[model samples]
Target: MAHRTRPLNLAVPALAVLLLALVLAPLAAVGWRGAGLSLGPADWSAVRFSVTQALLSSLFSTLLAIPVARALARRRFPGRGLLITLMGAPFLLPAVVAVLGLLAIFGRSGLLNSALQALSLPPISIYGLHGVVLAHIFLNLPLATRMILQGWLAIPAERIRLAQSLGFGPAETFRHLEAPMLREVLPGVALVIMVVCLTSFAVVITLGGGPKATTIELAIYQAVRFEFDLGRAAALAGVQVAVGAVAALAAWTFARPAGFGAGLDRGLPLSAPGGWRRGADSVALLAATLFLTLPLIAVFLRGLPGLADLPASVLPAASRSVLVALTSAALTTGIALTLALAAASRPRPLIEAAATLPLATSGLVLGTGLFLLIQPFTTPMTLALPITILVNCALSLPYLYRILLPETRALHADYGRLADSLSLTGWPRLRWLVLPRLARPLGFGAGVAAALSMGDLGVIALFAGESQATLPLVVAQLTGAYRMEAAASAALILVTLSFALFWACDAGGRRAAA
Candidate 1:
């Protein structure tokens, strides 16, 4: 029995080593290449701007999410479930598509400016620091709302009932019951958003370029692409890595669990206060819905007309993106499953770290390091798609690992002994026990990885040549060329494909589970 398990144990550690190498090798390359380099004023400016925008974006996102989350938790209305489902969309949305949507409403020739002009008011700009922060808020606000809503939902119904029985009004209830939850939840929410925004590449690249708006991610791109300064790019990559690490560390340290004990599995409604509170909740719901959905609607409307006139480059690029997405999804799901299974047998810190350390690294930083590592060997363009797939796997692995770990652990606990006693091992054991039980999460995780890879514009931008461009890269190129209609059409196609992949995989998982 021990000999039978020996092979499995050895395989897990070998894979863990590979995963760690993939993440750490790039950092080592960056350090080796930029060992003696110092940041210039502009690089420092980028750092400052990056930190400032992330802080502002996280602050605004979390603060604004409170009312909206509270409203969703306390109020039950038509389309409420649908609205909650839609909230997940923006988080998974392709940044390039989201930018186009935002531009449709906020750009100089966009709806808001047009309306301002009609009203004899000065038009506003969406090409600066504010625009970057606005886009981050747009992307992360839903996530914060969702997290805070979970906190609200987790509160024991008995506490709310007790408050009501004691004749406690809204303020007193909030003080006694809700405030503590917020205290426990908001810090973690804010820090997660902060970490996400800290590695923002697309938002800053699209809406922010000037020194005042540049982030370290964008600066790395400029150093590599424009200045052809590998040293500067590597140095900037190190800074981005450090910032991400610090932010991740801060989140882990400060974001403690809510510590609220377990509750009975009974259904009870939260207190839905009447009068002005009802009106406020209604407004909050409406505002959040509009804020989220309007930009997407704008993208659809703008893209419809241009679909017939799309560039010839669009189809090939779309195909390439699909290929990359599918390949990345399959690879990520397989790797995550292997790691998850290993962890289930016996939890190991190294395995967990290997799965998650990528969270503290950005796509562009990985691209930069890979670019440096590959330059000495061959032209990066020749291997763009493969590198993109690899980076996508690394970037998307953590999400899949988190999704599959618990299920894998449960499967092991429930069936491990039985399988071992019956001499179940390797292929036979996986076929009968592991695959059947883990199929749902595996499917969903593959879907998430697929959607994320399809939408990713980061690494591909650094390595892709004209002939090798993916759909997101093509969209960015079209936009850069001021071909708004073409860009819109391409963006629409990208969004459709991304969502379709996600839905098919997710629905397939559900069907298989059923």
Candidate 2:
């Protein structure tokens, strides 16, 4: 007991402390400055706008996610596996990539507009409140779908079979059985989306042409940093953080990192309903597919034509992104493994909670903290590549912890007694037993970290000087400079590279687990 339990307790907390310190830096900055800070009406307005847009985005995305998740859970179809994988893509898809893809399709010169011009109809506007919501749904719909399907997985097969035998129709089963699971899981999906929207910068920046549409995050950048109104920027940060914290708390409350799904029997055909329900599910799923995929399709179509116009700058920018991704992956994996190992035992509600804090605190926020932290010790913070990597490490930790903690908990719960009985402990137990058992999830954790790092725009945006620019940052720069074609090409390459990297890492982990 002493040998096995003591090391586990000591290590987990130590690792957790390191991870927590990094996440706390942002809150610490604002609080360290003091509570007497005042936000003007403008700052309050940004908060109100943030909440409104995020609510709209979350409500619409979740409502849309339901039918698709049900179809994926309730119906058998070809290409289902591929669709589920794509549903998880936004978790790694950089905000910049989605923004560029959206602009090509929805922008005035974009496909929809071109079609509108040909038919002499009023073109759809892609800037303002509508654009922010559009981009949010584009990123979140698939995520919410995946989460709901996972909830569907929680319904016992026997429970499902019994429900059918009792003559409960599909509608009844969904209402009684699936509805509860949705109730349970909806908070998690909504909370995740809300925090994401609160921290929104890139979405608002690219799409926000007018003052009315600005988010607190974008407003902060304009007011304090770019506009050089340090007082207003500081004021906005206080309001933003307060609002973000409230949303963060809500997210934490609804945080079922491990969620409940209704029921699914893999590859088994679900009982079908006639007419309206079936027709509705099919139609809704189709709309979601098109809504999510069309812009991405446009990225390829519009960007490919301009591939020849890809800046000579791309080769170097892409090169730097790859280096950053590789380094961030390795570093993120190391931190994940260490903290995961530390949290392997203990009741880690706090550490687990801390893991997700970075989700609320944007890369821009963290980068700002890191910039302030390092400024006394360094020149233009972007020049310090090592600090940028550290920011990436912090940014990627939440996904890594989420991926690793579940498996870690299971590993310890199931294996701890066995190892303690054997008097096996520390590296011996971990190497010989626990590590072997958890290889697949740990690798998945690593892959997730790497993929997210590859796509991250937050820290990189702040630290990416021309000399140190990452792919996502370079893509943003191109779009801003109106080198739209080059931006699109870079967006495609960035997305492809991130997916490939995740796949390779995850495959290796799975192979190792096997």
Candidate with best lDDT: 1
Judging by TM-score against the true structure, name the best candidate. 1
lDDT, candidate 2, 61-93, per-residue tens: 888898899888876678878888888888788
Cα lDDT tens digits, model 1, 60-104, are: 999999999999999989899999998899877999899888888
Instruction: Assess every candidate by TM-score.
Output: 0.98, 0.89
Model 1 scores a TM of 0.98
Every candidate's lDDT: 0.91, 0.76
Question: Which parts of model 2 are misplaced by more than 4 Å?
Answer: 1-12, 255-270, 348-360, 382-384, 413-431
Deviation (Å) of 130 in candidate 1? 0.8
Local lDDT at 306 for model 1: 89
- lDDT accuracy of residue 458 in candidate 1: 96
- TM-score of decoy 2: 0.89
Q: For residue 362, give model 1's deviation from the true position in Å.
A: 0.8
For model 2, name the residue pairs that clash.
12-342, 151-260, 151-261, 151-262, 152-261, 152-262, 152-263, 154-261, 155-262
